[model samples]
Target: MTERESDVVIIGAGIAGLTAAYRIKKLFPKCSVLVLEAKDRVGGRTYTVDLTAANGTDKWDLGGQWVCRHQHHILWLLEELGIETYKQWLDGKKLMQIGGHRIKSHNSNLPPLPLLSLLDLGRALDKIENMVKQVPRDDPRLSKRANEWDNMTLEALRDQVSYTHATRDTFDIAIAMISGIRPREISALHFLHYSSMAGSFENLFEADNGGAQEWKVKGGLQQVSELLTDKIGKENVILSEPVKSIDQTEETSVLVTSETGQNYRCKYVINASPLHCSVAMDYKPSIPLTRQSLANRSPVGHLFKFIITYKKAFWRENGFSGEILGNGGAPVIPGCDSGPIQLIYDSVTGYGNPALVGFYANAWQWRLVDLEVRKASVLKHLTEFLGEEAANPIHFIDKDWTIEPFNGGCPVNTATTSALSFFFDGIRTPHDRVHWAGTESATQWNGYLSGAVQSGMRAADEVLTRLTPEIKLDGLLQELDNKFPEPSSSSVRGAVVMVAGSAMVAGLCMFMYWYLT
Candidate 1:
């Protein structure tokens, strides 16, 4: 092995890749591991920006912000890292504005406006709970049931409930907005999966401090990436190196060439890139047809996020909870505030001064992106809902995930149920020296931060189990070097270096064995 070589070369430095590197190092200390990131920075979609410059605002999350208490993986990691999270505030009255009318509502009661809207919301929740119970966690029966549900659209389900025209326009559209897909376009199974992950509509609605409140790092989510990097060492990580092609030759050895022409040889390669982004990489012995098909069919959800800083919490003064729900049309912004973004908090809750983070979802946002007119439109909507005084936000920042080169979309949605199932199975099956470890590839918490970590750990463990011989030999060499450190001339340094190099090679072999076996 040479200086340019590593036992395993991981592509992407997002949470998934970083977690994989950390797990590999912890499990195989003797092995050499390298993490290559195409971007200048880590944290793929998890970003926090300072909005103080714009409006004397505090911290703002641009991507992947909220975490539910039931989301065990992310919560556990935060606990382990000693990261603090504040509950989002959602007390007071919530506005249910639709068809140009503002309807006030509470968590325990129906909105004061329309009976149809109330029934739609109630029926939607009941159906969601029933659907969630229908799908047992990790049940092999899921695939079969998914197949059945895949044949039906969300619109069809709504029709079964016999919702009125206005109710369908408001409530049905709202579901689509929350899921980032039109109700008619998304499969019913996907909705069930989302509901199951969320627990229930009531649980989803209730935030601890405010509304199913969001937690942020005192610094930023990027701190998690930094912590992982510190443990892996700078030498083992490479940035701005995009992998162009991967060649798996005889004996399970992989030759990876970057876009810059630098080549790296490794026993195993973990591709933690997003599904859509992976399509750009060339594989010598092409990936399975199923995987390729999945990649091609990958769904890119609507992309929209913004932060508005006002003179004060103006909505609060008006007896509003600082929360607004709407469909995207004449009334409510469909899928508005379904998550923590639906609930506004004092910008100072995490790390800034004063600002509110707003989130949007679904076809309405997709149409906005398609038209390239989100910023101005968002401003107009905010102004209308919060009044003209609250219209001119001091600071406004938005992230268009659709335009991201590596992440062709924001979070994966339910529309691509079949594609996701295929891709998940295909990638996890392993092929030669190639391994897959990404948030989308996880068996649990498939689209969350914790799933990414779990996938990384699984990939690392697989490698550790495969290359036992090399690891054992490297361990012995390391012991010898440590015991004979006093050698001055023709010293153990040379031997130690050799052992270090061999350990890396062994790590590669282990990865190959794990991937192949």
Candidate 2:
């Protein structure tokens, strides 16, 4: 077995790992750094491939594809790498399949529903936004209702706040698209924290005007990581080396062993993979139970993303925006068999090739199904919503994050019900010389590419302080601060008003009950 020594060792060569290596090398040139990745390629969750063989000349991103102006870290990194981005196509009307039968087209961001259902959805969203403001980004458990919120499932909250079936179904669809799981599986507190970190809950799904899906990189999102690897130097990164164990028993250094028996000795170690991936490794003396429990409880999102290339943009020609969402028809209740597809968007390639990108509703149900069967279902659904032209596509490609051994799944891992309240401390707290650097550990944009960059910078700074005591991290610290800004006064006042309004309503109800009795 080969042995090597470095100032620091980073596990996983994803965006976070590559960013940490780049920051360390740029700031402290003298410090030796090494990056180890289990996969043969880089980019972690971001995977871009050329579609030339499928009658397309442009590259397609099969994973983690969207970004917006508000995601500062990802935008900043793109600027640093000289990468360009284009706005998503949002000029035409959008279509929604209601009650798994009727198709409706609308120009607004919201789907067409009954007036009462819309009002209920608006009220529920406002209440959720207010509650989200009450949760702290640093430690959610510190909030007054943390335990209460964490103990309750988001599904239960939905049922309580929403008055109509449409409202409840809408919330379920949003949850499925954002988290790849049903509302009942996630914690209310965890969902609130996730939304708070993303700047607001609405920003999580909006496609236009600075929303999360507002833009796409010119070449592909993966280019950012590839460029970062170039800057870090290829020799410093070793691929196909899955770390089997980490031992920090020695006072001066930590030892990391790979599946191939190769050992790496370093002063500090940064784990940049997903939470579950870290849990797979055997650690000397074992990590804290809180951390273990957190990893054990938190599960990766099951997302099956696919891209279909067509000769023409038929939806746009039909005055349709190429965006489609289906929730098993109008009263859109949540069920595993709702449909094969959940959401889709116009994904014209960088070279101007027409394409449609989307995800499946229930990944587990379709993960093992025949590929042709899945494709047939997707085309039939698209044709029913868009037009006969949707049935024909020049090329098709897809990636199931569930089948990936390295990542387990894509988008992000979520905190299960009660997991955050009981094990929040273990999410980011370092143990011995080991540091965490995944999107899950970030304070802002927690599951996006921006979060990955922010976490990498934070973890690298943690190592720098110990490696070089005199190193000035003023710039790095400033960037980190921008990511975890304090809540606005206006938001706090809104929360207060919401609380007072609830109290007044309860008192009036009690008074009416007493008089009637």
Q: What is the lDDT of residue 393 in candidate 1?
A: 66
What are the TM-scores, per candidate, against the unseen true structure?
0.78, 0.91
The TM-score, computed over Cα atoms with residue i paired to residue i, of candidate 2 is 0.91
State which candidate has the highest lDDT: 2
Question: Total backbone clashes of model 2?
Answer: 6
Cα lDDT of model 2 by residue, 260-298, tens digit: 999999999999999889878999969988888998988
lDDT of 2: 0.83
lDDT of 1 by residue, 161-191 (tens): 6466655655453563344456766666656
- Pick out the ten consecutive residues of candidate 2 with the lowest summed lDDT: 328-337
Output the lDDT of residue 313, model 1.
68
> What does the lDDT read for residue 112 in candidate 1?
40
